[model samples]
Target: MTNAADARQTKPDWSAVRLHVVTGKGGTGKTTVAGALALALAAGGERPGARRVLLVEVEGRQGLAQLFEAAPLPYEERRVAVTPDGGEVWALAIDAEQALLEYLDMFYKLGPAARVLRRFGAIDFATTIAPGIRDVLLTGKTCEVVRRRAESGQGPGHGHDRVFDYDAVVMDAPPTGRITRFLNVNSEVSGLARVGPIRNQADAVMRVLTSAQTAVHFVTLLEEMPVQETLDGFADLRAAGLPAGGVIVNQARPIVLPEDRLKKAAQPGGLDQAELEAGLAPVGLADPEVVTALAALAAEHAQRVLLEAEQREALAATEAPMYELPLLGDGVDRVGLDLLARELRRQGAA
Candidate 1:
């Protein structure tokens, strides 16, 4: 387990990857990290033209829109923007219905069968209310993107012969509780398709996921519940034979004040009396109670800093390669996203 300081020092090699799946406990800023990573890869000016990056969201959460400051993406892929090196960045919100249709059309050539499945409650009930099925479908769709084949003029090649056209795909996958099952759907499909097309497809997807070329990163905050969940999630992924890529601690606070300075501030009457009087005199705040209140605020900030340190330590114990993204005091927007992109590059995540 590397401490926060050490974790920050270590750099991630993003060049050796084709897919980066970002997930964590809900509200842990998983979406933010996913967006930042996509931007970072796109902004890799020295690399070979950003490598046709695709940012995918499965839950229709509009996170990409919020991060990019653009309109929410529809079911299909849309060219969002160009990267610094003129590489195209495409964004998509995965619609289970559409993915299902595409899946049927590509493999089964099942014309109108997709509509029949929806009308007969097979697709609707299975994807909407079903627990594990929705995860399987979403995960299947993402895997499909990673496995999509380019046109060969004659016909699609065999499973491994088809080369992935997209350089990288960033998936803002499901939350912590469901992500394990989401990534492990090959086992489920294997049971259903013993010797058929689905079986082959499942095997291909599993191959890609388990390969070193693909990575899954979990984004978390330095908080108690998220930390615990991240630990558990890591264990689940490893147990299921899925790759445990790395951990990212989001919204980390800067330890601006040293411990000795913080302790002195906590001490009663530790502040310089003359300096306090001089600083408060200009504001016409002569009351000792007001000065005490101001001092208390500083003390509170110091305590929060200590709490942040403790949280970082707890997160470090998970032993995964960790990255810390600073807390943005100002709200997230395009400018904030640009800052995050630069930070990711500096940390070698790009």
Candidate 2:
């Protein structure tokens, strides 16, 4: 098994991959990393024509739009826009009903049955509200993207017409609390479909997920709670026999101040006193009391820095492959995403 720590140090060669699944605890910036990785893969393409890349979000959260600085994507797979190098980036927010309908259309020839099932609350509840069933449909749709099929334009009536499209698929999957169960739907479906079409489809999806060609990247922050969750999530993935990818430490502090420097800065007789006196003296307002007040301000900043370092250290202890994306002062946008893409490429190259 590949260690997470090493994976963090190494950047992924997207050219060699077909599927990338991004997941983590909520608010850990998983979606941001997914978008950035897609951008990086697109930007790093060898040929400049236009590599087809699909960005899939399972929850309909519209997180990709925020990363691209565009509007929320609809349920369907739409050609949103192209990357800088002429590579295509298509975004899809998977609606459970649409995915189920697509699945039925492709497999069961249930054209009219789709609407009938929806009206009877069978398809609606199964695809939307049902726990494991929704996951099955979502994974099924993803598998369709990866499965090999011939393109003869024949409908389900022919039973031999299928299409395999898209160069790469990035799934912005569910949070850590539910992701294991979501991805394990194949095992759940196996009990029902002993050796039929559904079983075959589930097995194919499972193979891709478990294979070395695919990866599952977890994103987290440098805080205590998120780091703890990341550790637990890794263990869960391992226990479930899923391939564990590297962990992304998002919004990490760029510089860490040692204890000695932090203590010196917080001291009353440190740089703050002399710096304040120099400025005040120029204004003819030098006061010992004002110097003390300025020193307190510096001390507060030093304390915050110390706290940030502590958080970073706590995260580093996980020993998982870890990549840190510095927190931008102005917050993340398209330009920020592009910057992150460059960083990912650098890491992937390393």
lDDT of each: 0.74, 0.70
Predicted structure 2: lDDT: 0.70
Over all chains combined, what TM-score does candidate 2 have? 0.80
Shift in Å, residue 295, candidate 1 = 2.0
Q: In terms of TM-score, which candidate is strongest?
A: 1
Worst 10 residues of 2 by lDDT: 155-164
Clashing pairs in 2: 4-321, 5-320, 5-321, 11-347, 11-348
Instruction: Compare the candidates by lDDT and give the number of the best one.
Output: 1
**Candidate 2 wrongly placed segments (more than 4 Å):** 1-15, 69-71, 148-164, 190-195, 256-260, 266-319
Candidate 2 residue-wise lDDT, 286-321, digit = tens: 889877876676677676666655665665655555
> Candidate 1, overall lDDT?
0.74
lDDT per residue for candidate 1 within 80-186, as digits (tens), equals 76666766567889887777777788888987978798788787776666444555556677777777765554222212223554567899998988787788877
